[model samples]
Target: MANLYAGIEGGGTHSILVLLNQSGEIVYKGEGPGLNKWLIGLEECVSRIGKMIRRAIDGIHMKSGIPLKSVGLALAGSEHEKSKRELKELMMDKFDWIESVESCTDAQCALSMISKSGAGMLLISGTGSCCQIINPDGVSRQCGGWGNILGDEGSAYWISFKAIKTILNHEDGLETSLHDISYIKEAIHKYFEVEDNTGFMEIFYAKSDARKVAGFCVEVAKGATKVKDGLCLHLFCEAGRYLAKHITAQLSSIDEKILSAPEGLQIVCVGSVFKSWELLQKGFMQVLQEYKSKKNLKNISLLRLNQSVAVGAAFHGARSVDQILPLEYSKNATVFSQIEL
Candidate 1:
């Protein structure tokens, strides 16, 4: 029997809690719906997470006869110190017996999953967009997480907003940067099940919620790509280029004095926005490839975490206690064959 550890990766779409043994094999796993505390309320969100934890604990102890000794939670909406403290306190209150508890932004946990020694950068483009860079020394810098109001430039939300505005502009016979949404006008109308522009406006304005509205990107992508709308394709490309710009700019922002990077700098990408759409991923990588070529930084590699981010979270949880398991464990695909996503 091996010591047990647990970890969680939480996001707006879903949450995964995984328990692992000393050999880095997943022993127990539980999944639940996602709730962004800011969008919902704190109590409801924490309660949902608590249910997931309890679910995993019940399963882990039942089969293994050993409780999780340590736990690491990589949660979304934990970008700030205050939120992290609040969530940590809540976890501690419920699972007081778990030793060496740690909490960090889900993005941080995603990075820990792909990079050994926590080197390289992580760019997430889902309901929102943000980038986290961690050098070998553990110091990190974050960019673009201003939320829907101020930033999140390359996010799905931004794309959805822009698409709606462009459609509206086209409907009103006004000039739009997209030139003409005329090609996909019928498709967009049918997709949203709206008869006309008035219905479109009413429905969009009524939804009001950021996540629900951002989901419009799915239709936007489908409509634009089906007809090969130049403007929509350009938007996706522009998004990729903008994300590339952030990546390059971070190189200059890192403090060289305190940080160290390993050979072949890795760019680990996580998020449904990039993952769900082939055109968008192509657009992003095409621009990123161009950027790499221009800068002659061929050491850069872009890799997506195909497995669940929960795998990363669980890896970090076990890593905290074991310390000897190579950080590169997750990088090797073979290591996770026994654990299904």
Candidate 2:
């Protein structure tokens, strides 16, 4: 029988599971509820993951008793060492058929998509935002990921929050810009399904829903890309600048040799916000250029992963058992931008 491995990428919004054969071919793929242990209890997260894996095995027509060689879980809220160890233990206890279990952060799994050497930087701007860098020697450094309240700058949630604040400020006569913000105002009201300020305040403050707020970024993107609204464009540009700050903050502690390498550093960008790179390019490039002058860096490559990061989690599972999956790293990523400083 072929050795079957499984991987799960658990996010704040949703979770993805993939089963891979020894040849690195994805045989079964599935998605289910969010697996953040903080949002849902740890046991519940593990139970959901187990059910997904069992369904995948059944979907592939595998026998009920067939054992999986390994399983990898890349989940949000599992970044800390304590969480990783606890998750691995629970998965082992629940699934006796699994021989090995590996647990890591979603960011780490995303980075593994491109950097086999484990030497690269990853910036995530989804419902939340964070940046992480791993050196060639295996040491890792991180800059952001402070959740919505403390940080999450440049995230979808941030953009949506900014949009609401801008409208409120305008209504309060705090904003001096005479440029018509009627479109954005209307978009905000329609997105939250609120007819007035009182309704908006109730939904936003009473429920305090992060996902609902983050979803508004889709409207913000439409406003910028489809409607060509200036205020919406400014929000994205500002988001780009904040994301650039994450990179610069990480780069500050990097070795000078790594910064001056001829091939340059690889920066893997992940999330929904990057879909509108056309709008973000201006403010993102502007900050990068300024940082380049200050640091005298050689160059940098910005890339996007073509495949779902669940594949990376599977690769991590294979590596944990001293096995290597034959995958084309180059084909898995595309260079969106390369800056020569």
Residue pairs with clashing backbones, model 1: none
Task: Candidate 2: give its CA RMSD in angstroms.
Answer: 1.9
- Please tell me which predicted candidate would have the highest TM-score against the true structure: 2
TM-score of each model, in listed order: 0.80, 0.93
Residue-level lDDT of model 1, residues 122-232, one tens digit each, is: 878877788888766777888887777777777888887777667777657685454556655665566567777787556646655676657767776765578777767
Model 2, residue 38: what's the lDDT?
A: 78
> How does candidate 1 fare on TM-score?
0.80
The superposed Cα distance between candidate 1 and the true structure at residue 28, in angstroms, equals 3.1
Off by over 4 Å in 1: 1-3, 58-67, 95-100, 177-179, 191-207, 255-263, 276-278, 281-296, 318-341
User: Candidate 2 — worst ten consecutive residues by lDDT sum?
Assistant: 254-263
Clashes of each: 0, 0
Give the backbone clash total of model 2: 0
